[model samples]
Target: MTMINEPAHTLPVLGEYDVAVAGGGPAGFAAAISAAREGAKTVIIEQTGMIGGIATAGLMSHWAGSAASSVLQELYKRSTVPDIVEKFPWQGTINPEKLKFVMFEMLHEANVHVLLYTFVSGAVKEGTTLKGLIIENKSGRQAVLAKTVIDATGDGDAAARAGAEFVKGREGDGKMQPVTIMFKVAGVDYSRAVFPGGFEANLDVPKGKIQDLSRQALPFPAGHTLLYPSSLPGIVTVNMTNFIGIDGTNADDLAKAEYECRKQMDPIVKFLRDTVPGFEQCFIISTASLLGVRETRHFVGEYTLNEDDILASRVFDDWVVLRAKFNFDIHNIDGPGLDKNGAQKHFPNVDGYSIPYRSLLPKTVDGLILAGRCISGTHKAHSNYRVMPICAAMGEAAGIAASIAAKEKIAPRKVGVKKIQDVLIARGVKP
Candidate 1:
């Protein structure tokens, strides 16, 4: 490979805050809200126009978490959608848009500063500590200083750019799970479609039936295809198909995957309309605003969680967040092939698990804390904690921790986990 040298340009530092959160996803939202609630001058910088990253932008139907014993329970308790749909007697389903609004309301009420349409490009580091971050937008590139920084970019973009130790893809050549482009189809028939046992059963439709279908097949991005109900009536969101053998961190590869995924969409809609009993008149509405990335850079933290922790349903003394059963949804990385038996594999757990604060604190970085899927955890454990609801809890903890650090004028890692947990408990978060 040939390298070209480009001169680096010097930039001026902008404003400072007690805490600066990069990314406005579930974790980022929670972090900013919690930090502001603790009286910290907090700022959230997001590239997307909306606050909810994947849940809103990708229009993910229902969050993948157990209805009982998890952070999702807290979400339900705080959500207004339940109140709106309470008369229907239906249980457990969050409207992505409503949830996004709820997060926005919380952040607004907490007085957190929001900077949407801004992307974090790089960071200013001194020794091992992050002094500030460089962000770019319509205006120009500017630096935002903060006493404490939390990386909830979901891809560990901030930490990875700041010389933090990280891992990408999986072990043994670093292959990762497949990426999907989720879209919604309207005009589905409620009566004809099999509702099995509700969301879980609807999701776990027998792959044998899917594979053995003699009808017209849905063209997918060279992998497994599956569809389940969204929040709206007579609508289903498709998580079908997979973009295989693509590295998510590479811009060129990611762009190709997105293009390939889009090309596979129409035939999928056609197949569903032709073959699926309920989707005869179903039409393709819209694809996700952003490409759905399953895995990305994993920051190395003080404690790396593993599959053992997931299976054991481990509890930590410094536990700061709660997680429900999602599973080790590792798509075959060897290359694309028919995953006729993919959804059948389940992650058996005794109960929900606790995410330790140590997992969020990088082992090397002194001033930065991590939240969301990028937290210090093994590749296997990442599969479980990578979802939205759990990330919110992690964000809440990181935010409060950052606020405490700012107040005490200490580095984020140096803050006591017990104190953070206490703040979380006070803020109605179950640590």
Candidate 2:
């Protein structure tokens, strides 16, 4: 690799605030809105035109893992069909279109300064502490100064740029999970639709592999045509079309994944119509504007969680997320198919686990909070707590902690778990 040197220049300050949140996804949404509600002047910068990141942009509207927080409750209440998940197999579902607007309305109500179509160019750092973020948008490159920073950028973009110690992919191989392109199909016959635990498929699996997959009740030739229904009738979500070995944070890999995933749509829809019973009339209604990248930079934090903690459903003294639940839904980075404890140890029951606040505090950085999939955890553990609901819950905690730290003139780690827990309990977040 070669480098080119450019003259250094000072950037104009975009604004100053108590808390500056990078990324406006589910986690960022909760983080920014919750921070504002905590009496902190907060600003949230998003890379896309909309606020809801993967949930809305990636079109993966299914909400699994843990109970809904107050923010999620309000979001679901204002949705077009609040009870969309009444019959859905998943824990919850959302109308992605309506979800976007609800987040916008909620952010506005919380008085969070929203910056859309903005990218975090770099992290503004003061030693190990992040002072703010350097953002680039239509206006041009600028700086956002803040007392505290929340790294909800999903990929840990801001934190990584700030020299935070983090891990990428598996420890040895550096192979991360595959990227998915979620699409929607219309004219589905729900009564005849066979949702074998979130999947529909074509008649193309090898006999021996089919038997192996059937033992686990996993869709044969799985990771090909999984179906998650939408709130509106006749429209169903397709969670298949996996591109293995694609690094989400890599630009070249992402571009390739998007193109390849989109190209799989025609075949996938055809497979549904030609093979599946209820999807005989199904057609491609729309494809997501973004690709759903599962795993990325996992910033090493105060306490790195592991599979044993999740498997044993361990609770911590500084628990931030109360009773989080999700399987180790790890996609094969070296091959195809989902790896859910088959290669590792299977969780014995459906018991939920707790995530500590310590996991959200980056070990080497001050004045910064970690949220979403990027928080401290091993590759296997990341697969467990990387779901939407848990991410939102983590974001909620991050916001409250960040605000308290900013107001009290302390680092996020010093905000104390008791203070954050009290706030969460008062907000009706049931354990």
> Per-residue lDDT tens digits of candidate 2, residues 1-431?
99999899999998999999999988999999899999999999999999889999988757865644787777766764644443454336778888888899999999999999999989888888889999999999999999889999899998898889998978787778888888888899888775533322323342323223432332222234466766777788887676777889989999998887777667667666755668889988778887899998989999999989988889898998887877777876754455543232344636888899999999998888998989999999898788888899889999999899988988887898899999999999766
Model 1, position 203, has a per-residue lDDT of 36
The lowest-lDDT stretch of 10 consecutive residues in candidate 1 is: 195-204
Best by TM-score: 2
Instruction: Evaluate residue 290 in candidate 1 and report its C-alpha lDDT on the 0 to 100 scale.
Output: 74
Candidate 1, 1-431: lDDT as tens digits: 99999788877766789999999987888788878878999999998988888878877766666412223455566663554321222334556677777767777887888888999999989898998799998879889999988998888889988889988867556767778788888888866764322212323233345433412254533434466665567777777646777777788988898888888887777766655677889888777887888888888888998888878888888888754566665555543332322332455774888888899999887789998888988767787778777787788788889999999999888899899877766656554
Candidate 1 residue-wise lDDT at 136: 97
Position 171, candidate 2: lDDT: 76
RMSD of each: 3.5, 3.6
For model 1, give the RMSD to the true fold.
Answer: 3.5
Lowest lDDT block of 10, candidate 2: 199-208
Q: List the candidate 2 regions with Cα displacement exceeding 4 Å.
A: 80-91, 198-223, 340-347
- Model 2 score (lDDT): 0.81
- Check candidate 1 and list the clashing pairs: none
